[model samples]
Target: MKKNIYSLLKGKFLTSNGASQNWVMIFYLLTLAIVTIGSSHSADQKVHEIAKLNNEVKELRSIMIDGRGQLMKLKKESYLEKKMGEKGIAISEIPPHKIKVKSQKE
Candidate 1:
């Protein structure tokens, strides 16, 4: 009977309003809230930076894609053959291309 009463008393003490379980739960909630706020702040900044880089990549791709046809035309063998024929070593009819640029109007 004494042991039974002592067990009951111990149960009441450990399960009262000031129980260790309640304090531990409160601390866990507080820590979760703090970590959530910290991760949100860092993730928000990273998202903004990723969006900026994506926009920059889009702009550069637009610039690079602008002259696809002209680039293909310049890279053709026909243009190279024509240029080589013009600067042919067989005949000296045409004037040699000079690096110095003289104004056409002057």
Candidate 2:
């Protein structure tokens, strides 16, 4: 079997056929390297994006906390009355009135 294979491969590799293999191997390596670099770059970009988003989320959370405090302050009726009074508004005490209504069904 070895003798038969050797006879079959005889003079088949004595030419520049193996030289072309070098370029083909280099091309394959270059393609693989480019793909790997591209994927790594994309991963880095994603990490940067995630970090940026995290910072934005932290900023929004801080703003929400500040807004919540402002909301709490504004929820007070006394605060509104004071603020409105500062804006040239006036208030007067009045008596409540009751209304009598009739049903449509007899």
Candidate 3:
């Protein structure tokens, strides 16, 4: 066991008769490490992308709320009457009447 440990420590296993299996195992572990590192980086990028999208969503939501508020103000009766008054249009004092028609089926 001591001899085996000493040979392993001295890197003799890489030059021994059974070194082919050791080389394959080393290559496998190296590939696994590379894949793990790549996946970690990919996950980090996705997290950043999600955070950016969330910020954009919040910004869009605020813009939409502001636009809706402005629209509501513009659609108010007082605002419309004021704008019409500027254009020489005035509201008539007479009451409006709705005409009803009877539909005849042939």
C-alpha TM-scores of all predictions: 0.45, 0.67, 0.86
- Ranking of models by TM-score: 3, 2, 1
Output the better candidate (1/2) by lDDT. Answer: 2
lDDT of 2 by residue, 1-106 (tens): 9986885577443345575776688789999999999999999999999999999999999999999999999999899899989998856678778997888995
Where in model 2 is the C-alpha error above 4 Å?
1-17, 87-100
lDDT score for residue 3 of model 2 = 83
The global C-alpha lDDT for each of the candidates, from Candidate 1 onward, is 0.85, 0.86, 0.97
Which 10-residue span in candidate 1 carries the lowest summed lDDT? 84-93
Q: Which candidate model has the greater lDDT, 1 or 3?
A: 3
Candidate 1 clashing pairs, residues 3+ apart or interchain: none
In angstroms, what RMSD does candidate 2 have relative to the true structure? Answer: 7.8
Q: Per model, how many backbone clashes are there? A: 0, 0, 0
- Report the alpha-carbon TM-score of model 1 versus the true structure: 0.45
Model 1 lDDT, residue 97, Cα: 86
Q: Highest TM-score, which number?
A: 3
lDDT of 1 by residue, 24-106 (tens): 98789999999999999999999999999999999988888877877988899888777778887343568988698899999
